[model samples]
Target: MVHEGVLVESRTMRASVAEHTEALDRAKTLSLLPDGMHVTTRMVADYFEVGIEAIRSLVKDHRAELSENGYRVLTGAEVESFKDLTSLDKYTGRHLALFTRRTVLNVAMLLRDSIVARHVRTNLLDTEQWARTASTTAPVDNSVIHNLVAWLDARIRETVAHQLGQHDARMTRIAEDSVRTVIGQTVVPLLNHAIRADDERRREISDIRREVAAIDRALRARMPVGGMAAMDAMSWREFEEHVAGLCRRDGCVSVANTSRTSDLSADLVGRTADGRTLVVQCKHFAPYRKVESGEMQKFIGMAKVEYTADIALFVTTATFTPAAVDLAVRHGVTAVHRGLLERWSAGRALQVLR
Candidate 1:
């Protein structure tokens, strides 16, 4: 007997089957066996030209329904018996899910991705219409009607299988053409966009590097070449006033020159626009000389503790020793070298040399 919708009550099955005779037709069209014969899961997969794994996945998802409708897990003697019946000596595994013709048809009706299943459905509809016409005009014998229906079903299945084979070949050619079309339409534009973005990034970096190099050269050119001769010409008090004036010109407010010996670490004190106290220590040394780390250590202590300044600037007419610059950096001090002093004195923006 057919096991399709076997889980449902006999009364419900009759009502449902009467309302949707197409489902029964689809089953007959896709079935590998004749009306009374049994089929397996692998047989159904092969008949539909789809993967066995696809059938297994469908059975796994609809286990309850499929199991009730002629799906069985063969074990022990049943497995060996099945192997013997099929003459498959290599089929040694047990606990395998076997599907009947009804279950296979059920899977075909439910499957969404298989093109062969779709063709099977269409062929079933066509066969059902032909069967209806033949039944009305044909002889009253039940056996003759059954034989006629079986023949028509076989013919429909064969035609559909041939069409699916041709479709598979056509799809293979279409897939090959699609690869070339995708490379031209999609991949090439993405590659071109990446190339353009990379070029723009390189151009922007080059422009920034050129601007920085230009600023560096201008600062170096402004540094004194004649040593302390240019700076020593002015008095010590004049040098203190020069630093205070430079600070005031460069956004420093409330500038004061405390040049007396009592002024411990700060020679000039001012407030910036952001209201941060600026503490500066000036050294008008010769261009050949460098400020030592010992002086920087003393200035760092006063800036952190005594002055409580937000920005500590160590300005000099000479450059700083590597040790002095390192210490200044460690303590977050801005070490203004001779070039920076020249740049500031010339009214250019102060670019602190940390």
Candidate 2:
């Protein structure tokens, strides 16, 4: 007795009945942003009576299906372009995800455990039921015209069956031949032309890419050696970003720069390719300054004791003092001093830590 539209658990069925998006309005009001055409992630969360993170998680899980129904993420230049279009100047984030009406309804169908979503499904079922009842059951008059209509229907059914019953195989063959003829006349030639042109363009693009790569290699050869001077001139914030990029380049997954986090200031966190947790605290100091033993001890407490990292590294532009070096060796902390950092920046891996 359950309708397919009410089966919110099935994504396929939900998408099939996405035209019933008006059911969302019937269930509850869907407030849109200034544009009135698209809704932000926050707006969608508010409509569903859920948290913004919940909406983000749902989008991540059903990305492809939701994208097909017009869910989209805008970033960088695209975000700016959208801001200009919508005049939504309040948003200053790097990324913005917008949802169309169909996309929100799609979420409703896929979302469970929300009273609002349940009400939407109920309205969807009602719409389907109303359409069926309204279209299929027309009232008839009890008169002579009714009898004539019934007699005509019976005669038409009987005559159609008698004439077409023996021609079923011939009809099927005609339908298949028509389909093959249409495909041969249109689809096959278009496909062949498209494939040939695409292959030729691909070869030309490959040649251009190779030339660009050669130019990039030549440009790099002319740049300053090791680029250590550039690091010394960089600001503290820039240094933190540069070191995090190095960690990412060395086959680290989920490498994050937690410079703003209070627990570990200017820390690079990720897991190595071998599945060991790596934590690096960057010290963007002058090469003339030396890291003292007291600073090394504090780093050990934060990186090892607090973070419980498998590979705890203290990377600095300055060299460690003799006492600091001894403390680092005793505690198994890989102290990446100025010399080691230069080698690392010059494309050498931190094999000692691994």
Candidate 3:
């Protein structure tokens, strides 16, 4: 017998029963796309009878596992192309996250709180055991999984072809690489492994699929690589909030965004682990733009002199210009350009604060 929280906590058990997404229907009716092959985040949240934030939180924590089961965010022309194939509302933003039935099942296995998710997990476990016993003698039907895979593959090829705009000589290589990346790298190898392996052996395939997803994400993503890539998408106001998050993560207490127009232009203010005043100025600029000497000079003096900051940080998605870097060094401010910002956001300790 499975323990009470076994399915919610055990990734291996989840994978074993994930194909049994029929369990979800037992919990509640799932509203899928017109084609019945995909569902929006809202749909998943509604079916689980949880708040939308609950679904988003689960995805945030277990994206890799959910992604392996066919959750993906569509961007740019891919969004338009996807809408052409099926309706998507304006509020989806520039990027839209979609999920397959298997993806929903993966969520059911991971989510700990929702009553519907718990019901689905329980049903899935029971179904899994019965299927194994049945398959030992009778011929098990594989039509559901087979049809889903076939339709999903064709749709992926269609979307990638359209989104990459595989035209003109210049874009040909890019299109080929991106298409080959999603299809060739992600799906094909996993499908082959699933076909060859028995149920127990499929556990080993999970880690390999995760690695494949990482590589595939890098290739197809419009998002930049590394920690700060997400910063590119943030508004200036949101950037301040993000820095506050980073500061808190690194053990700052009472961190808050203090965006102001005064001589002390610190966007964030907090204290380090040792209670030293920490101040930060964030420049949410494009990569081509640099933190100029004037901006750096203003911040350096204000953070150190006006605010009496012990740790002054100048962080930007864009790098620092030579003059700005020199001034920051002279003033003892840590100039976190794109590379250093990436390192910091990726969880490396800010060496200076320590």
TM-score of each: 0.35, 0.40, 0.38
lDDT per residue, candidate 1, 18-126, as tens digits?
A: 3232443332233322112345677678767788898888888878776666778889997776554333455667765676655665566556666666644444444
Clashes per candidate, residues 3 or more apart or on different chains: 0, 0, 0
> What do the candidate models score in CA lDDT, each in turn?
0.63, 0.74, 0.75
Residues 127-212, candidate 3, lDDT per residue (tens digit)?
66546644563322456558867887677657656776736755755665666677777787886565555444444345545765
Give the poorly placed runs of model 3, Cα more than 4 Å off.
Answer: 89-92, 133-354
Index of the highest-lDDT prediction: 3
Show the lowest summed lDDT stretch of 10 residues, model 1.
27-36
Tell me which of candidates 2 and 3 scores higher on TM-score.
2
Q: Lowest-lDDT window of 10 residues in candidate 3?
A: 219-228
Q: Please give the ranking of all candidate structures by TM-score, highest first, separated by commas.
A: 2, 3, 1
